[model samples]
Target chain A: MLTGMTAKEVAKMVKNKEDLFILDVRNQSDYQDWKIEGEKVSSINVPYFDLLDGVEGVLKQLPTDNKLLVVCAKEGSSKFVAEQLVEAGLQDVSYLEGGMKSWSEHLEQVLVYADEQLKVYQYLRMGKGCLSYMVISGEEALVVDPSRFTDVYMEAAKQEGAKITHIVDSHLHADHISGGKTLADQTGAAYYMMKSEGAVFDFMPFEEHDRIRFAHVDLRVLAVKTPGHTPGSVSFFVNDKLLFSGDTIFVGGLGRPDLGGKVQEWAKDLYDTVYEKIAAMADDVIVLPGHYANLDQEVNAAGYVGAELGAIRAGNELMNQQDKQAFVDQVVANAQTETPPNFEEIIAINRGVDVASPERQQELEIGPNRCALHHTH
Target chain B: MTSNKFLDAKGLACPMPIVRTKKAMNEMEANQVLEIHVTDKGFKNDLTAWTKSTGNELVKAEEEGDVLKFWIKKGE
Candidate 1:
């Protein structure tokens, strides 16, 4: 009998580095563009059209001993194919529930920090590498850089016996759609963002309020009006304990400044932000970033994607450039020119300048994140 | 712009449009055009890639509100 597996269960298998085999049934180009990836995930692509008649042709390529997963764009085809595999005497055959679309939107929530005063949780978007966060204190919670799944945050807030009172978008995201506005609307939370991001929606600008104090959050701006890749990029310094670095800094490298076509100016501003604004913080402050590239390399033993400010500074040679010119030059030279797939549409929808159906949004966001590039490599 | 045959694949799900198109093309002569209309949004990319890999020519592809139209010329 064939069974269906949720994305969350598959995420656990990937987390444990379990040996698995994935037979992706989407078109060749679709599979080549973006698909599930992990250190232990071994997969192959055979277009769904080829298997409509039967599954006998591809059986030779299947590994009988490995955990077999059939995947497609939606759950329909995978289930259809998995049934055929079962009839062909394959054991332990299963399909991904809701298919790649569900996998794309699946978030693995991991607790990052907790104390008597506050508790923090990080939601890692397993497929897209996008990271969102929530901080609970007293009877209120503050969500930072939420993804499109508003219910996940709202539901999580309820489970913690707290209400979502504040929502912040660290910057105008280019890779994925921001759930800040939707989440705020659903929970009656005060939405915050930079006014210069050109959002048409009502939001509390970070410029007017230097400090957003509620329950226990003394959220202060470390850097606003960045004028880097995105003009309104702001870093949230939470209670002077954790730094929500946004896209400005990553565990592997700095956020590439070439997205806005003014690499020189952006790179210079990034230099100032790094050397002037962020460097003042002590080494022990944990840096929670907006996105990650390699999970194994970026995630710490604590099961979250963050690092100590001191370790990030001491480890990366790019952070030690004393001369502004050399640092700017290096940032410009090392920047990745490839922009995120369908960024224009995603940005327009995020800015509230346009709207799309849920299907359209998922179609637009079906690819890997290209926002962070290593300044070193 | 002109096709010798028409294949209406509207309302079909994954693999159906491509599956029908392949069958229709097999019965066509070399250089004959096969016009297909599909509702699956993903078929846009699939048709483009399918034509390229199968050595067929995609004469034109356009969207009409909810439907995607394609013209594939069978290759020898």
Candidate 2:
């Protein structure tokens, strides 16, 4: 009996040509942005409500019922879907325990794309890849979405001789712990996110059209509500050039539609936001995603948000055909193979419930490798 | 009422057990006695802070078998 592969196992499988099916359950925009690569990789638009429907079809597509490794932007939904498949008589069904997000963090397997001046880190956690800004406007300065590893951001800031004056979380994340709070507290930098995300956390929140001005950097953090991924998910556009998409959009995939459990409503919202609000921006405006799929067997680290916004435009056929109904249809189809076992723990921690102490945090988080299943932020 | 109300909040995380105790205290009449059970290391400090901040009377607080028990009276 073949169980689900850990991120490490998945990495090995990618190296060796295996007859396994990698099923991606996140929405279309997310799938296009970043996806795990396999000659046999298949994408099913499964929203949470129509999760069973989505899984039934994917099951039909598999050959010989050997082992189907289900995947999603985050691990929670994919794990849920995998368990459901097992219940539905698919004996050899397994999912990436932490999903693709785990693959990015634990295995360090991510797809990266870059231009001469910028680079994007793809596929970090649950389609919520952190974006790092290493700009050399006046000095070698970095901004936004540092990891739990504070030293990385600190070192970058020091090397630039540029103080990190601002740290912004695109939204209150449900996957991966927010290193922003710690970064701000340590560096005396102003931590900012949309007012919606700000309501839940005890921090200084920035609203729409707020501009973060530093000595050499003038970043206009536009708070565009892209709430499919989470209730307070927002997209931040800096200087009308780079967009910091938290979980709202992905490189090859859209965020999980059933997030906040309003798949129908969120699907429509994503449609308007992406086609009208986001697509309306200049074609040159970079589309930085929260995470990307590591379908390419070559890359070992996810692309950064900054790298995404600069290059990944709406020119891709997936982005150009911005049909709201199609996106929703995909979401409705994919939700079945998407439920995970430990989503409640993730949601509780994300909502600031039952997390009053460090021990409580530890208890909720099973491991540091649980980048997608447990809400660290 | 003849019955004394007691609460056990030992070794529990914050915001949950504390919130429950507060709700229980609210339902009790004034001058009623309530006991809380806690085993978390920081419970002593948290409970003490809560008592001070809420103006409740802490009649007794003692450690027994790794559990910290607190006797509190409803504030006037």
Candidate 3:
């Protein structure tokens, strides 16, 4: 019998510096578009159809020294191929459990907080810097900043024995399509965003200082108006413990304020939010940001992509810059002119003004996320 | 039975089949049936719910091997 390895398991092996020979049986086009990327693992693309006639010819070419990992679109082809390889007298062989589909959609959920009353799971979207949160309080849960893969959140909520009660978007996202509306519609949860965002869709608009309460959960999420990344951006402070800083402040630095075409104005707002509002917050408060530039560096030992506000403030020089004019100048100077890929289309989709096919949305969000500030200083 | 339009959404993932179906239905006349073929396993539930919400009529849905075939009649 061939062993089945999940995408996460394979990722761990690669991280551990294990040599892996990944044989991808997906079609050439898909191989060209996107495939598993790892530091030590090497991959070879051979469409499963090519091996339909017989595996004898292909078997001779595969390396027997390293562990062979077979992968296909979903699992059927990869399993078939792995079985054939095992029958061919290969000593070690395994196939990806759900194949490339699972690999592409793999999400690593790390528990960020756990206490007597509440637990929070941060779903880290590997490769992409997008972060979604599930706050489980008793039998109720609230999802924050959900991506289009609603099933992940739904399943996570189910596993926690909680029903999704509310969905919230920090702002009108331009980097990726917001799943808030779709998820809310599916779960009958009240979807929320800042009323000032001018979203065409129907949602319960929340203002600053509004507390979102879940039934039977001793938790209250306070909406804090940040308004730096976008005019209506707001951060969620959960029970005064963790702050969901959505695109307003990242671990590396603050979110680039120039995405809205008003760099100077937005930069000023960002500076105020950073120096004025965020400065007043307790240093011990954990800051769970919306995006991270480098997962390898940003993710802490706890596996969550965040740190204490004191650490973030101490690490980021921009946070300590008291000169408001100089801060604005530096931010404006460091602002990137190149916009995120398909940002306009993504914004339109988030606003409920337009819709994109799944394939199109995937293509739009295929590249590395450029939502965070890349400037070192 | 004849259909007004045919959409082959096979091998496509979620929201693609629905997005294409919406576009095709927009160009179609009321009461015209749009035939769609898809391979994504989730499309069965997705399409059923989509049609219900949009007021379209799912005349027939049959599975032949791996492909799911659906005929949706446009609503006014």
Model 1 C-alpha lDDT per residue in residues A1-377, reported as the tens digit of each score? 79999999888887777887999988888798778777788999987777877999999999999889999988877888889999999998999998888998999999999988889999999888899999999999999999999999999999999999999998888889899988988899999988878899999988787578888778897653654345525688898899998888888768777466878877777778888888888999999998888877888988789999998888878888569998888877887778889999998998999998888889888877877534343
Interface RMSD of 3: 12.1
Alpha-carbon TM-score of each model against the true structure: 0.95, 0.49, 0.67
Please list all clashing residue pairs in model 3, or write none if there are none.
Answer: none
Candidate 1: the clashing residue pairs are: none
- State the displacement of the C-alpha of residue A363, model 1, in Å, after optimal TM-score superposition: 1.7
Q: Judge the docking of candidate 3 as incorrect, acceptable, medium or high.
A: incorrect
Best by TM-score: 1
TM-score (chain B) of candidate 1: 0.96
lDDT of 3 by residue, A1-377 (tens): 58999988876764455788888876566566456655567888876555654689788679988899998666777887788889989978999987665665567788999988889999877646678898899888999899889998999999989889989888888877888999999999889888767689888887642678775343333334454435625678877778888877787877776467878777777777777678888998888888877665677777678999999889888899569998888888888886676888888888988888887676567544567536334
Each candidate's number of clashing pairs is 0, 71, 0
User: Of models 1 and 3, which has the larger lDDT?
Assistant: 1
Candidate 2, superposed: residue stretches over 4 Å from native: A1-142, A198-200, A222-232, A295-318, A321-329, A335-343, A347-377, B1-76
For candidate 1, the C-alpha RMSD (Å) to the true structure equals 1.9
Worst 10 residues of 3 chain A by lDDT: A216-225
Deviating ranges (above 4 Å) for candidate 1: A224-232, A373-377
Ranking by TM-score: 1, 3, 2
